[model samples]
Target: MKSAPRSAVLHRMVMPGHTCPYGLKARHLLRSRGYEVEDHHLATREETDRFKAEHGVATTPQTFIDGVRIGGYDDLRRFFGLRVADPSATTYRPVIALFAMTALMAMAAGYAADGTVLSIRAGEWFVAFSMCALALLKLQNVEKFATMFLNYDLLAARWVPYARIYPFAEGLAGVLMVAGALHWVSVPVALFIGTIGAASVFKAVYLDRRELKCACVGGDSNVPLGFVSLTENLMMIAMAIWMLLAYGM
Candidate 1:
């Protein structure tokens, strides 16, 4: 008779009030991957600490396959050839989620104000929300965003400080637009940055034919440096124009 496959040991945190989320994830992953899991639940904080110390590991959700340590959840992912280990892999998911959230907010705002899911006010709100969201993303890691922006932003390439100031400018514009105050400041700023951005994106992605990541969503983004970048600039331009036309001058 053939012997059954050996089980993998999964030692994870399970305390009185809280259980580690990654531990649950690791357990599920192991079971879903057809490994019989020998789940070892750390019942208390002291037990969890002791387990970590005894295993010479720093985190919970440690896995052991055939007596060889597989580290934590990320390590288990690596062992199974999953995509969790890579930090620099390009993907559009972040930008997609951001834009999706923006759309949802815009729709809700529109409906709340006008009893419809789409309207001019909603459009305005959407642009303002997008500016804030994108600014926040950049502000999360300004250094990273600046490094990426320098790759294609003509102004940032020429003046290093421009990269650092860009997020603040975007955030200020977003706040002013949202408040419906200081149009003079917001409009000019939006037009200035949007026009420069449009030209730079066009030159770098179209004229130069260079494939690069967009810093529109942030420095760590995997968003492609083409349509999405262009769209961002164009939206800003359109919003500026709309605000000007709506309020005059």
Candidate 2:
């Protein structure tokens, strides 16, 4: 004889204009775990509020198993002995992904253009691609990036607008380098920012021994201020010097 299937009750908000993502996740989790979910939809704001009040809970997507409250999505994960993510934890995922993607892109570009991925041009593309990608991340929210950058950047501390201009300059330099055009413009821009950035990062993370979030990927990133950030700045500096020497600019 087979055992009876486990059952769960899920109360989630499914308004006309919006649906709660956590609620969807909860339902999926329950179903995936062999629980038959009696899904209830709170279709309006008033209905959702009333449900929360009646249950004495602050949030929706509440789950119940065997007549016991399982709370929200994170709570449900806890019930199943799953690891919950801590929002405050420092992570290197963003930087890792950014570097991995840019590296792949560089190889692809090299293979397509020069018929080889192990050439000097490929290495140049890697650095240029990384610069553009990092600049793009910073450009997403300049105000936020500037705020984070001011915490450690010497130039930004002195001149507020430098923070805002940094991303654009980096991007322009990267684009020019990739095109192999306007070495006069790209070399100087990359060298100037790279020098300042490396000095600032070294001072903050090495000399001061401060544990802070890096603004390399973006203002919202949780990547620690350390070797990866230093490497990024150093790569730009090296690329700028190489361009200057190679083109005699």
- Say which candidate scores most in TM-score: 2
Cα lDDT tens digits for candidate 1, 67-186:
999999998998989977356777778878988899889899889878998887777888999999999999999999999999999898899999999889988998899888999999
lDDT of 1 at 28: 92
Off by over 4 Å in 2: none
lDDT at residue 130 of model 2 (Cα atoms)? 93
Worst 10 residues of 2 by lDDT: 240-249
Q: What C-alpha lDDT do the candidate models reach, one value each?
A: 0.89, 0.93
lDDT of 2 by residue, 134-247 (tens): 999999999999899999999999999999999999999999888988988999899999999999999999999999889998889888998988998999999999987887
Highest lDDT model number? 2
Off by over 4 Å in 1: 1-8, 12-21, 31-36, 41-86
TM-score of every model?
0.77, 0.95
Assess candidate 1 and give its TM-score to the true structure: 0.77
